[model samples]
Target: MDAVNLEEQAARQQLFTTLYQKVFPAVAKYVSKCGGSFDEAKDVFQDALISYYEKSHTADVTINSSEGAYIYGTARYLWIKRYKQGSQTKQLDDSSAYSIIAETEAAPSEDKLLHFLETAGKRCMELLRSFYYDNLPMTRVAQLFGFSGVRSATVQKYKCIEKVRDTVKQKALTYEDFLE
Candidate 1:
């Protein structure tokens, strides 16, 4: 079984290497002409390759007839599907757009709330982290936090949530407050 798995992995690696060599330049050219960066082109090409491979494995995909064209078209379609979805027609080449995103994410109001949570609500935050962030089961959380059982842990979890909810309501957090 291990040998068979190794052989399959080798075949897949070879296929990927061959496809990237044979088809990537054209995909990169198309992406660049479309004003996308080299990294974005690589991402699109890799995703298209994986999609093509998966489709070929599952069905009678006739990608051999025009491998280059098929790969390029798939990559372009994926890029458009990913980046141009909804009514958003944002340009990928614009650095300013990304910087604006970074700025908004760094909003001062949310930071203040988070900092307050860190200080004032540290124990609740720790419990939430153990259960939710660390993905510990209620049983394990109860064990770690010295609760009697899962039910006790779960009740405490809800209590923490209600406390945070009340705090948020009391402070009247808004979208702008959440944003940087």
Candidate 2:
């Protein structure tokens, strides 16, 4: 019985691999067509892969739905999320109102800055997030994060901000020269 179950798992794995190989490029194309670059498409595709994994692991898991359909649906949802987040102007439409709450919580620049801060270092990320996103005072942040005092916290926060700024500048440079 164990051997049979193992064989079945292997078969399912192979099937999933085949489906991903067949569908990813198509989803990428769809993402690019919808105002996203290849990198963004790749990110969306990665998210969709996680979504697919979660769906596949469910107790009611069945292959009755086409894998392509599942992935495409997830990719579409991701792309829509990306679009709503990127757009500056708010125009309410009935269909999208349910998802708008999550999208409106942060500006895109703040999101990118947060992502950069996260990539910098855990300590820096925590310090910056505590100060900025959580709106904590320097003394409070220092006490919470074990910094020596408010001045030290202030300096650490400045350094973290500089690191985040540098990361953003570097990323922006890849697209266009910031000085020009």
Candidate 3:
């Protein structure tokens, strides 16, 4: 039993060493092209290697690609995940500051804009809400709205936007006339 365990360990070590040599350069190059530092690339690659090790050990999980390709892909995915998380946090911090200022200055205009959207009719409101506020993909929006396909849903979205724009312009002019 000890002999078998030792042999398995040695085999695993050899596999990892070969994978590191073949895959690390490609992963590092990809990370560099994606604006990550060498240290970040190394960190992500290490995590990827660990993930690959875990997955490879599982009986039900079959890797369809070569070990190097799998490792490189995992590294690329990890780097993108890390990059998105950092950028999202940064954006939230920046947007919090801007939201405070915009709320105070734009309250009246925001109300007027809401009124214009309300006048645009309920179906248009639902369509826009599904696509923008809910962040559903065009295909899902099409499914929700019973559109023929993604192309139709996209076309309708733009038309709805144009309708809202025209409505806002016309209402603003009338509102200005009323104030006078």
TM-score of each: 0.45, 0.40, 0.49
The residue-by-residue lDDT of candidate 2 on 1-180, one tens digit each, is 699999988987887688668888998889888878988887887788778877887989765677788887888898898888888566779868866775565335645445666866899988887887899988899999888889888988888788877887777644222212
Candidate models: Cα lDDT each: 0.82, 0.79, 0.84
* Candidate no. 1 TM-score: 0.45
Model 3 segments beyond 4 Å from truth?
91-180
TM-score of 3: 0.49
Q: Candidate 2, which segments miss by more than 4 Å at Cα?
A: 1-16, 60-64, 89-180
- Tell me the tens digit of each residue's lDDT in model 1 across 38-135: 99999999999988888778766556656667778899998778667633765566797788888767766756666646643777888988987799
How many residue pairs collide in each prediction?
A: 1, 0, 0
Q: How close is each model in CA RMSD to the real structure? A: 15.0, 17.8, 11.1
Q: Give per-residue lDDT, candidate 2, residue 141.
A: 98
On lDDT, the candidate that comes out on top is 3
- What lDDT does candidate 1 reach at residue 21? 98
Cα deviation at 87, candidate 3, in Å, is: 0.8
On TM-score, the leading prediction is 3
Tens digits of per-residue lDDT, candidate 3, 5-101, equal: 9999999899889888888889989999999998998898899999999999999999999888888888988898999999877755677888877
